[model samples]
Target: MRLDLGAIAKAGTSKANQTGSWRNFKPIFHQEKCIGCSLCKIYCPEGCVTMVEKKKYTVDYTYCKGCGICAEECSSSDIEMVMEEK
Candidate 1:
C-alpha cells in the first residue's frame, strides 16, 4: 500500500513541537539493563517515550529538556542522561 509521505511528515513535525524541549536532552536506553517495566515511559512529563516494539521503548527527544525524570523513575537504571550540543 502506498503511504502518504506528506501526512507522515506533518504528523512528525507536530509531534516534535509537542516535545521540542526533548531535543536538548538525549535518553540512553540500556537494553541489557532494561527490564521492560516501562517506568520511564510512564513518568516522562512530555510523554516522549513510546513502545517501539514488544520489549523496546523509544524516546522522542524533541521536547525532553534533559529533565532526567525518566532516569529517576527508571527502576532498572535502563535510561541514562546525556548532554545535548546546542
Candidate 2:
C-alpha cells in the first residue's frame, strides 16, 4: 500500500479532537496591531484561526495546538505566543 502523505481527506476535523489542552503555549491576537493581512489564518497549521470580519480574525482555543506558527508568521506582530495558564 502506498502512503498518501499531506493529503487531507476532510477538513474541520480538529473540532472533534479538542487538542488545545495539550498545548504549553497560546496565541494572543492583538487587533490593534493587525493589518488585515490574514497571515495568521493562512499559516495556522491546525486551522483554528478564522476571519472575524473583513480585516479581523479570531483563534479557536478548542483546537489550537499553540505551535506559534501564526505568531511567527504575522508580519504586523499582531499575534503573540504566551504561556498557557491551563
Candidate 3:
C-alpha cells in the first residue's frame, strides 16, 4: 500500500509555516450552545475545526483563516463570528 502524501511533506517546511494570519474575522465556538450539529466542521474551509468529542469541537488556529463559513453554516448558532484582534 502507498500513502498519499500531498504538498509540503517535509516536517521543517510544514511546521515552520503557519496560516492563521489570513483572516479578518475569527470564529468562536460556544460549547454550551452547540447542539452537536457538526455543521461547523463540515463548512470550515481550512478543515481546522475538528470534533474532539461527541458534542464538542476544537479549532486549530494555526491554520484557520478566521473565515465565517462555520458560523454561517451553524444552524443552532453555536459558532459566533468576531473580529480578529491583532
TM-score of each candidate structure, all chains considered together? 0.67, 0.80, 0.77
Preferred candidate (lDDT higher): 1 or 2: 2
Which runs of model 2 end up more than 4 angstroms from their true locations? Answer: 1-14
> What digit string (tens of lDDT, one per residue) describes model 1 on residues 1-86?
56886645444455535455436657787666777889888888777788877667877665666788888888888788777786
Position 7, candidate 3: lDDT: 41
> Which clashing pairs does model 2 show?
none
Which has the higher TM-score value, candidate number 1 or candidate number 2? 2
| Alpha carbon lDDT of each predicted model | 0.73, 0.86, 0.81
TM-score of 1: 0.67
Alpha-carbon error at 62 in model 3, in Å? Answer: 0.6
What value does the lDDT take at residue 32 in candidate 2? 80
Better model by lDDT, 2 or 3? 2
Model 3's number of clashes is 0
> How does model 2 fare in lDDT?
0.86
User: After superposition on all CA atoms, what RMSD does each candidate show versus the true structure?
Assistant: 7.3, 5.4, 6.0
For model 1 the local lDDT of residue 26 reads 73
Instruction: Report the lDDT tens digits of candidate 3 across residue range 1-86.
Output: 45566643545565455788887888888877778989888888777789989889879889888878888888888888788779
User: Each candidate: how many clashes?
Assistant: 14, 0, 0
